[model samples]
Target: MQRVVSNLCNLLCSHYEITLISCYKANETLPATYNFPTNVKIIYFNEIYPDFKLDSFWDKVKFSYRINQLLPNGSKNILIVNNLLYPFFKKKNTIYIRLFHNSFENAYKKYLYKKPLFPPRIALFDKLIVLSSKELNHWQKLHKNIEVIPNFLPSIPKESSPLQSKIVLSVGRMDKGDQKGFFRLVDIWEIVQKDSRFGEWKLHIVGDGLLKEQIEEKIKAKNLQDSIILKPFTNQIEQEYLQASIYAMTSLFEGLPMVLVESASFGLPQISFDINTGPSDIIENEKSGFLIPDGDLEGYAEKLKALMQNQNLRESMGKRAKEIAQEKFSKEAILLKWQKMFNN
Candidate 1:
């Protein structure tokens, strides 16, 4: 929502009154501050509690009730619901557009290990928007109104440095609490650190996670303390992309990661394990990036080495990546597609 909504505001700032409504109030300032016009109104609907986790029954009930009652009932309100909130209320002539950020079946299987709670609500959605072509295919097997609308990152800053560091970076929620693919990333990183060839290169992880302690333990056990640097989250991730040469991910799955888009915008080619559908769509193997065969740690390590050893290949691919990003994924270009959706 950040990419599309923010870009939408940018595109129609002068013509439309874009109000950004947050379900739960945030204590800290909005991340990556908005450049909204004076016409835009940002407001919070539900009270934010510090201890509310979605897994709790009481929290879920309270949230559902609050959401069901609080949505703006104004005739002009276009209730663009994110995937998780689609099952809750009803609105008429509200342009009930649903944005599916992740693959539904994959996420439900990974998180719930059960079927969706509100199957009927899924059927009632007027339209579904997803980031990758693969996700459109996945959903279209059951629904016809699904559309592909890829997310875009703003252009890299003028002062951003060229891809110079040999460091391989992966950005995602490090919380081992979810059990999604945190361990798999740590395992692959350990394998990458064992070779002396990567001695000159660093494995810098930038994100906070519940599994920080466990991730640290694995690094210490492999005596990769010096080789691997676990840094906390930073709002200025563009700098991380600027210094890094390669973006690596071992996610078991995704809905086309924003980090990969951000990384590629600066010509930092990716090396990711084949997930259910996102990485393969973004990373063109041996062209702009390499997609390691799924669950192949040894192959991932070797691919990383090949990119690291040959600086020319890395630079060439990074340059090609920047071209692809500029031509296909800029916010200005992608915003046109969204405008067309709104028009339809």
Candidate 2:
């Protein structure tokens, strides 16, 4: 979300008077991880509520108060907030557009025990902006006004991978055991390795999280210490794509997975579970990549093995990936959509 905000503001700052309100301190010692244009103003509200936790509604109220103080009246301002909605979000004349970061069905599927609220809390905003059309259709069933504006690629590479390396790339934080599906990816890699032909291949996962130690233990248990490597989150993620021949993701769901789009920019053939929202939007099923059925472990391995064995097939699919990235996920294309939204 930080990357998204930074990139969006960088693009908008060229045309709009942009102010970036953040939750963390932005001082000499602690600055933003991503660079912001000089025109974009920065605000750090963390000090206002020194010790914060999501234990109660009053805690959310304090958080909202900080937000309100930064841009109290929304009369001429368009408040694009993803942080949290209200204990106090009602601002007169403000065009509130809440960014729903996850697929509509993603959280519900993960937490089946918790029934979803009718209409969902996103209805609190004047407009709800989602990343994919899949989720757009889902919420349209409720007759809520929504927009499908996918993520824009942060940068497009001048050179794509040659598809000659024996490495597979997967990038995302392992927030929990399942959200990004690194656990299932480990399970999938184990199956892919059953064929001795894949002996020299490597799986490079780049990201760090609360579950990092547990994922490390799982790799050791499988004796995949050498074959499967876990890399820390990187600022230069393009380097990972350049070093690999293919990309794969086992995510159960997504609101347009940026990694998949990033892979497309590097012209890497991808293999991913056809979850509720993301993969189908970017991949042309067998053209740019393969979209395996959810939980079809064997099917995923079979398709990945096919790509690993044939260089021609990987190159063909990768070429299509680059084309798709340019035509659909370009920054200029998405910025126009946002411009229209902001104008009227």
Evaluated with TM-score, which candidate comes out highest? 2
| Model 2 accuracy (lDDT, Cα) | 0.83
Candidate 1, residues 201-320: lDDT per residue as tens digits?
A: 888888887888788887788777887888899988877888888888878778877777778777887788877777776788899889888889889888988888887888888877
TM-score of 1: 0.81
Provide the clash count, candidate 1.
4
Clashes of each: 4, 0
List residue ranges in candidate 1 displaced over 4 A. 1-8, 28-36, 46-77, 83-93, 109-117, 158-161, 177-182
TM-score of each: 0.81, 0.85
- 102-124: candidate 2 lDDT, tens digit per residue: 87775534333463543455456
Error of 1 at 90 (Å): 6.0
Residue 113: error of model 2 in Å?
A: 9.6
